[model samples]
Target: MDTSALNEALAFKSYDKIADICDNLMLQVASEGVAFQDEWPYAVHLLGHIYINDINSARFLWKKIPVAVKEGQPELQAVWEIGQRVWMKDYGGVHEAIREFSWSAQTQGIVAAFSELYTKRMFELLVSAYSTISIQDTAVFLGMTEEDAANYAVQRGWTVDSESQTMTVRKHKVATEQKLDPSKLQRLTEYVFQLEH
Candidate 1:
């Protein structure tokens, strides 16, 4: 399959198409796994996870659209709808109604305006976590220091655990459930919630 097709599908910005494409890709991945007779590898799952997370992040960014921007750019609503369709397709039997993070609708509702802002806030928390990077083999990916990074996350309503040095992101509905599905898509969804506090 053409990998570029995925890119094109994502760029479409129609929620239905996005969800459909996501579902198609996911089905392909599953079929490939079955053909190889191997459990789905971590890398494959990671790819799906990244796809979902990035879109969610985009959704989050969509929220910052100013009132003037909305009025001036009514076409944005169509773009967002397309994106939702493309990104939110049900993964197997994971979702009941719309193809969104399991708790997304319940947590934030389905209204585009509300979801846009919610997604943006979630993205902020996520970006804050990568303020700095450390390479495994003495390599380095310098960025904002851990302190500053943590502070950045904290500003977005996350509770930075200085003791454990581990950040715990809270979701909208379920506060006790810290972990999400092991699949990459699930991980991305959970990660955003983790960053959001």
Candidate 2:
């Protein structure tokens, strides 16, 4: 997919727009028997990120948070609900629906495997971010070899302090006032995923 296609797919402000794009992408992957390795998961994560990070959009989508809390549901449940809504809106609902819109056995298997791998990998990355994990520990957690972990860190431009047994993700000081472009980052992510694809 081209950058414009990605941008168009992600720029969807309506559920129908996103649903169409996602359903198409899923169908393409299924027909080709190609796994949804990189861009696929990144696209899903990007949508989740946008929902949580975009003030206006997220404000609208997350309105149920307080309602869920008032009803005495767990906060995580609320978050999960939001996530589910985002997924359903963008991706033509869920697995059953996506599967029902299937292609062939090989294609279906590819899509299923890709979805599992993408979600698992994303969860591993998210969990590591919230925990004090060693490189080897995170490598195991992500089901990646140590070299793959190191390579990813390098790609992210994080400094590896081997002697200290830690890799420090360089933080930009607000005082310096630098910003990363969301679209650029998305492109980089897409490009990386395309390599695996």
Off by over 4 Å in 1: 9-22, 26-45, 50-146, 150-197
Q: Give the winner by TM-score.
A: 2
| Per-residue lDDT of model 2, residues 19-131, tens digit only | 34554665676688875443343323223333333324434434523453425533233334434543444322332333344334322333344345443544445344633
Estimate TM-scores for all models.
0.21, 0.28
> Model 1, 36: alpha-carbon shift in Å?
7.2
The per-model lDDT (C-alpha) reads 0.41, 0.45
Relative to the true structure, candidate 2 has a C-alpha RMSD (angstroms) of: 18.4
lDDT at position 54, candidate 1: 58
Which candidate wins on lDDT? 2
How far in Å is the alpha carbon of 197 misplaced in model 1? 57
